[model samples]
Target: MKSNTPLIGILTSSKSDGSIAGNGPLFIALQKKLISLNGISFVFIPEGMEVDCINGYSYSPEENCWKKKSFPFPDLVYNRIPFRTKEQEETSQLLFSRLREKNIPFFNPCFIDKYELYQLLKTDNTLRDHLPETILVKEKNQLLAFLKRFGGIYLKPTQSSKGKGIIRVRMEGPSEILLEGINKQEIYPSFTQFWEEWNEELLKKRYAGQEEIESAEYEGKRFDFRILAHAHYDNYTLTGVGIRHSQEQEITTHIPSGGKLLPYHLFQSSEHDEFFQTIISIIGKSLSEQFGFFGEFTIDAGVSKSGRYYIYEVNSKPMSFDEVDIEERKIENLCRLFLQLINAYPQEKNA
Candidate 1:
């Protein structure tokens, strides 16, 4: 049933039984956009399926829903695996290897490792100052030393998203420390006691210690910026910047962590805009050079009252933004990338 339409394969997660696990809405939106562009899109789980075909879901325009179907290998594959652990699985790696073996074009192929990306970006002189002071939190003394230097710091899981597993640590006094998590706060008499409870948690997953950005307040609330960018015609373009405001002392300004979204126009500093644009462009190109092709990425950044900006994170698989305009532009830009890739790697009858 495959025809001449450009076929796009979205690589996402699935349950053990091969049912799609997440990103239902995003898949649908992407399908609709591709349809509008005279293309076809389908969601496929890379769980060691048939070598020549994959079991996936495709939109049924007549039924207004997605229907499970067997599809030929797509012209282009867009990696959207939801979790880092899943992306690191042996099966996923095998699938990626197969794609490369067949000479298929894949963009944003995997989730970017946080500490690894930090190490890469810090090597660039232009981006070094814009990054926060960060280190792998492996020992109690290292944490204590960082706290002493910054007075306040944040501990973040290297692979998590949506502000999960983020912690804020501040020196309550010489004898005590204040620890803030997404939903709980506790005061420990000393770093020794805190490490006793947190060391095991850190051992459970990789975590990074970063200096807290004393960001400028909007309406007495802390805020940060999400600068969304995409690769278009071999160059990175800033799609838009979003502002998220913290809710009642929240450790992170992520919407899922109870942060409120603010209009981007509220903070109109031309200097800030230019800074984000220049830095994001640098980051996009750097990532492209370091790691193969990347179609999209979002930079989580904060601005201090002193006008200093810091990049907290860069995510390869960014979540859907709440802003309607950002969503529309993202879809449009993504469709364009798909078209470019489709032309670049024309589909082979057997591949």
Candidate 2:
């Protein structure tokens, strides 16, 4: 049967040294499966350098660049633009806007649009409840209030990812607080100390702007859930659930902070089994209907000592697969979702 499956163009950042980012081993398995499917072709578009022309026109330049005027307009775009500086974000938004105007189907249609996410949350009470006590604060006063209320809070840039610009503030007592970077080991005894040290470090090396942190503690060990979800055609699937447990004195469960990933089932003690299951089901349903999320995305969630689960952040674009065999089920689920998407759009041609 003749098909019209669109060519899927994946746009993602290249390695700092300009090499093509290899699909991780887990994704390679899925890629192999996708290639054998009836309709669907994935083409990688590596990040390219933007150069200013002599006439003030900036263009993306490559060694063997095809003129933009002659290149094929992609029918489907799998956007994986990693977080960048504010200026880079603006440029990326402009590029994405152009693609949207051209009517290209995007995996995450507009993740960069924070207003859309906010709007979705506002309308859905269930989803909103599951999220952390998040507030968009423009001033330090609002941040201070949040910190006071949460005791120890996490501050993160609304659009940042991969644990960048994530700061953890621990309330030691009434007047004392400890602050640490999401990835770094050093700790500051107070906010003032953190600011001075952070600023000094920033002067020595560039970092993203400050972020509003979310704070929560669990067990004697602080941890967070990395739940992988996907939307395929009209169905939403929870592909995997893993908990990242902080190692040593780290404040975050981010892998860069020496955290280890454990299966979600580990939380299923005889006492909390039903409770855990209920929360997972509730979260899955709420996010699927609210976000219209398609393809793989991840959410970081934390549970307090009192058993209250709070979602820290949601990554609209999640990491491809990981090394552990435990990820096999997730890979399979993702592959199935990809196949389902292809089946739904069977008329489109593979690239």
Candidate 3:
């Protein structure tokens, strides 16, 4: 290992022309930060690479540009392959196996399965209370039973992100049902009618049924919280909390789904801050115990009308927060983590 200037690799998908795909700005930002810290950074795809050396784009500090170059296998890797299908490909799997065999540490290797994540957290007694009632919905009976129990439920594709493939159902009356999706809503006379019309969409993907969280609202619209955490050694550090509010009647508070980002201070409280930290610590411990090492992640939670919080999901590959301070801290923590991993930090600092 190059203790003074370790090589860091950012693994992401590539375009057909062999250019990087997704998170372009983030890759550049990471590279620039690494250079400022006197380390080397490269972005690489997982296919058609030699065992000892990789062909990718490396940042040149002197030229202030990314140049096509060949780099030896990096001391540490940061996986940023955005799509689940791409990450599941044979080539990507081979690359992961090679990294493991070589003892090259990486984080967020793959997306989390929604159902599995819920089940894992449900077993943690400390976290169980914050979780909404969730179940795997493979049959109509399962869906119907849950709807009867909760009166309203959310059907989410187990392997999706960014508010995609989510269907919200509300039981307005004993025989009346309301179905909502991204920017779309419908009224059905009965559950049977809705099922007959929507079963195909539900069956098309593996979905999980979760009891709807009655979220705290601002001016008749719902808002939720996103907590970003970075795992420092075995402990997770709370980098920032970002609040996103949904547009009127929207099914989700995800920013891309017609939701607006709000400053955390607009609704922040010391009690909520402490509550979020406790959840972060418990989650960090639970996930690390089950999934080995995780360097960064985000917890999505909703504050109910009664001021109680419910955890909606834990995202392994957290999206970049647009808040300036949060983004800066994210990059700083990431760079420091790389330094820590390669033993590049001073002995006193590490201690």
TM-scores for every candidate against the unseen true structure: 0.95, 0.68, 0.93
lDDT of 2: 0.52
Ranking by lDDT: 1, 3, 2
Please report how far candidate 1 places residue 255 from its true position, in Å.
1.0
lDDT of 3 by residue, 179-267 (tens): 88887889999888998998887777888899988888898889889999987876788999999988754688887777899999988
- After superposition, candidate 3 runs with Cα above 4 Å error: 1-4, 16-18, 61-64, 344-351
Choose the strongest candidate by TM-score: 1
Whole-model Cα lDDT of every candidate shown, in order = 0.86, 0.52, 0.84
lDDT of 1 by residue, 2-37 (tens): 677888999988777766776787788889899999
Candidate 2's TM-score reads 0.68
User: Which one is best on lDDT?
Assistant: 1
Q: For model 3, what is the alpha-carbon lDDT of residue 333?
A: 94
Q: Select the stronger candidate by lDDT from 1 and 2.
A: 1
**TM-score leaderboard ranking:** 1, 3, 2
